[model samples]
Target: MEEIYAKFVSQKISKTRWRPVPSGSLQPAETFATGSWDNEENRVLLWSTGDLGNLDSDGGFEGDHQLLCGIRHHGDVMDLQFFDQERIVAASSTGCVTVFLHHPNNQTLSVSQQWTTAHFHTGPGSPSCSTAPCTGVVCNSPEIVTVGEDGRINLFRVDHKEAVRTIGLVTECHSTVWIDIPTSSTL
Candidate 1:
């Protein structure tokens, strides 16, 4: 027989991803991350499913998924992706992108970098700007790509505070992918 477990988190979950287990390791995935949306205050949270292989007196899994750590998010968590074992990248509805670093030793999460108002819209003759929702994000080690409702795509390097490049005027850019060519160009 197979077993299943569930938890009732107060906020609606928008996205979730399992932490990648190191290669050649004997353990199953024990950690995961979650992003919440439509709440008074949004957040990115880490959870741990303790000892799946351990059985209780009743022959059930040992413990439920326990909260490891969490941090407040500026807007609705539009998308979430694990940049690496210790880093998490989140896109926001406020047109901001943030990278969070997880400290396993202390069980803490901290803001590593952030790009505020990375996406926005401006009318042809208007001097004011409106922020657009960043709908999606993808990561390739130190490089991250974000797409927004403003039809803009931005490429960022984790160590830099500013965007490396921006591709504007795309139509409904909800997601993106990196393509490497033989000639040393990425599309």
Candidate 2:
């Protein structure tokens, strides 16, 4: 077993996802993206974790272990996952889910898509069902699944950010998965 540790910031970390390498790339899979939370401003960053334990305690890595790119987010990031090698999906506290694309040649990251008001919590006194926080999201190519604190789970397709299906009236749901609930039609 091997342990690798890299330090980037003091803010609370929300998620980290490694970039997937294609079959015939000359470069190995060494780049990763990270999301941070609980600070005055939230941020997402791309970093390269070079050799383990290469820093000399001066907050600097001797080699390529460093931050590559960063972007400011509207709110704290709750969760993040890679939609593909070049893209990432992030769930935010502002009730938004955003998609980002990474360009290696120019080393840039850009928001490619977003679903505003995907999930939200209107505080303790909102009668609307839309007042629930989004908890998690999962991507399976043509499908993207999301769960919310209001006990709602939504399914979306890649081409459309809007949900194709929504399961509501759920409460305090933190996470969810896609499962085959038997239908009478199948019987």
* Residue 19 shift from truth in candidate 2, angstroms: 1.8
**Candidate 1 local lDDT, 140-166, one digit each (tens):** 877898988888889999999899999
What C-alpha lDDT does candidate 1 achieve relative to the native structure? 0.86
Which model scores highest in TM-score? 1
lDDT minimum window of 10 residues, candidate 1: 177-186
The TM-score between candidate 1 and the true structure equals 0.86
Clash count, candidate 1 = 0
Shift of residue 50 alpha carbon in model 1, Å = 1.4
Best by lDDT: 1
Error of 1 at 9 (Å): 1.3
Q: How many angstroms is residue 96 displaced in model 1 relative to the true structure, after the best TM-score fit?
A: 0.6
